[model samples]
Target: MEYKYKLAKLQYDKEKNEELIKRQRKRAGQVFPKQLEVEFWQQHLEQARHNINQYFWSGVLIYFIITVLMITGDYWIIDRNFFKHDFIHSLLGLVNGAFCLLTLFFFAHYKILRPYYAYAAMAMIFWAIVSMTWLTMTVHTEVFRHQAMMIISMIYIMGFVLTGVKPFHMLLTGLMAAVVAMIMLLTLYIPIDVMVMGRVLVGSTVVGFLISKMLCTRERMIFLVMHQARLSEKINRIHAEELLHLSQHDALTKVSNRRTFDEMLDSYFEQARHDEVPLSLLFIDVDFFKKYNDHYGHQKGDEVISAIAKSIKDSIRHMDFVARYGGEEFVVLLPETDAHGAYAVASNIFKAVERLAIPHSQSLVDSNVTISLGFTVYKGEADIFKSDFLQRADQALYRAKQLGRNQIYYHTLQVEEVL
Candidate 1:
């Protein structure tokens, strides 16, 4: 089971990678053909930047201490007359200049936030060490030649530890530095054991590469965790929105439920009143719906209601609002519509239901299922209460049912008849 689960997870990850590649292709339009590679480097750059910003000053302080110690150790322990050499001043100047340059860049990094600074700073230090290696190889004293190799090894370890160079760049810089040191020692004909020197150089380079690889893996894992968290957050937000939508809509009819209707009515009425526009309401009821439900089953009754709701939606304008007010009843709100527009909409809804031709053997009004509609248009103002508007529309609906159903009754100044 565990093996199968692991295989499934691997497949899921592969699919995600493909999707990411497709999206990148579409968005970039051929710029990033190798999406995963580009994405990995981009993420590495960001992570490196973050790591530098967090620990850069501290790392610089440690580097300064280590460099000072190395120079002092060489002068005191390895070569008592180190400063007497003709090239000593140049060697110290080069190393000091590189250190100062890297320190200045660290201060500027806050505003710059560029990855190239890291590369450039490391390059400066790298060359300084190379120059020192040459000076040490050419020194008159033969006994201190191995000391130069030891110092070079210290430089490698210190650069990796204190500079926080990104892993890929670190590996490249370390390998190049090691290779150059070996070549320089050989070219200068320094009296040293070739076997020992090669062992030290190759061993240090291998260790540095391993350490850099580990750091890269750590950064990649961090980036993946952050990316997954962001995706999960987005997914959760989408689910929350869907739940909210489902709560406001009828599961059966797929129309706004009573809760949504009440909320929307308040909002629309307020807007219409502020804008000084007219608002209309249509209160609709299915004719003899209880009898139809009893004759057929409640399941068929549900189908009929859903069909009528759809017909009402099809007949209305986009701006109009429809809601399942209760069983066998629906309400519509038309903003900025006058009594004539409401009447026209009601007549169309009547026709839409009739066109459905759903046989209702138990319906008292007609052989087919039908509806009665009543509507009222109000000149949006503060003078009239919302309940009064609803009551007037309800009275018109009652009048339509009394006038023998399947008809429209509209109330404005007084009761008005609509076919």
Candidate 2:
């Protein structure tokens, strides 16, 4: 009977060892993908390029429509019944269309030649002056007088509207105002037929230009105020988001803090439960961290922690999360990862931390920095609750600490089930 009892005890030990080996093999089968950071910024850059293209094409369409209208108006110049003769009317229409097309091309093709659009607009205003002079000097019919005056007035108003569309192009506005003033002054000396009509139209155009300028100034002031308000609101929002992030994240390492880790665990528990997917959690404590702090001082200790966090970030896939659970303690969340997968991730983290090799003179485990990890993985319809999963990992961590504090451990039941 005594020999039989001793044999049974030896067989139990052998089965337990085999189960542990089987669990390790199962975990080794799962591989973690490499992490990449550049993909995030590329998405935003593409969106900005798309918006610029859209705005440029819309401006081109507006210019095209204006050019078509000027071309059609040129046909009316040939009718002698009209106020102006065919030659003068066609000249005005052609000048307007040509300038409009030139401005459009400068804006579309050579963005660097934006200043040239103002010069082209100035040329258009010069033609307006010349047209008004010819209408007063050569045209004799009373019917032509009112028509010519109306056309000059329309040209001045159109120039003012165009200035509003491109407010940065001040040269265009100044040239148009100078032309109107010159035509008004020229009427005083020329004494051509219908001098009164020329003076009245010039005076009205100046008044209209001044009113439009005033309106533009008021609109700009309002826009500035609105812009400032938006800037202030945006700054406040950014500050709020930063504050929230800081509260939930480790200041030294920029990883999720202990409170955030707990909150995330609760959230993942619910999600995994609903989706019927596996969830794994890792409890990692840096081995001999106290000795490291003692050897390097608190400042260097902070740097070591930060470096480890970066290493963990580099090793894990984007879908996995790494958080600073507490002082020298870190946690990882692996969605859709089973017990075997979790052990594989934990082992990789172990290797990553060991490779850091931050010096610690007082450490019993090693003179260089290292980590001990405990992990748990749960799958569908398991009788285990979240607390049970955490307890199992915590127990494993305690065992690793007892076993010289540089190794990883998993639950016995999980290991046996795997075996």
| 250-340: candidate 2 lDDT, tens digit per residue | 9899898988988988888788888889888888888888877887798988998899898888878898888998899888899999877
Q: How many backbone clashes does candidate 1 have?
A: 0
Off by over 4 Å in 1: 1-44, 53-173, 188-200, 213-239, 315-319, 344-348, 413-419
lDDT of 1 at 419: 35
User: What are the lDDT figures for the candidates, one per model?
Assistant: 0.73, 0.63
User: Can you give the lDDT of residue 66 in candidate 2?
Assistant: 65
What is the C-alpha lDDT profile of model 1 across 154-173, one tens digit per residue? 66665565455655576677
In candidate 2, list every pair of residues with a backbone clash.
Answer: 77-86
Alpha carbon lDDT at 340, candidate 2 = 77
Clash statistics: count for each candidate: 0, 1
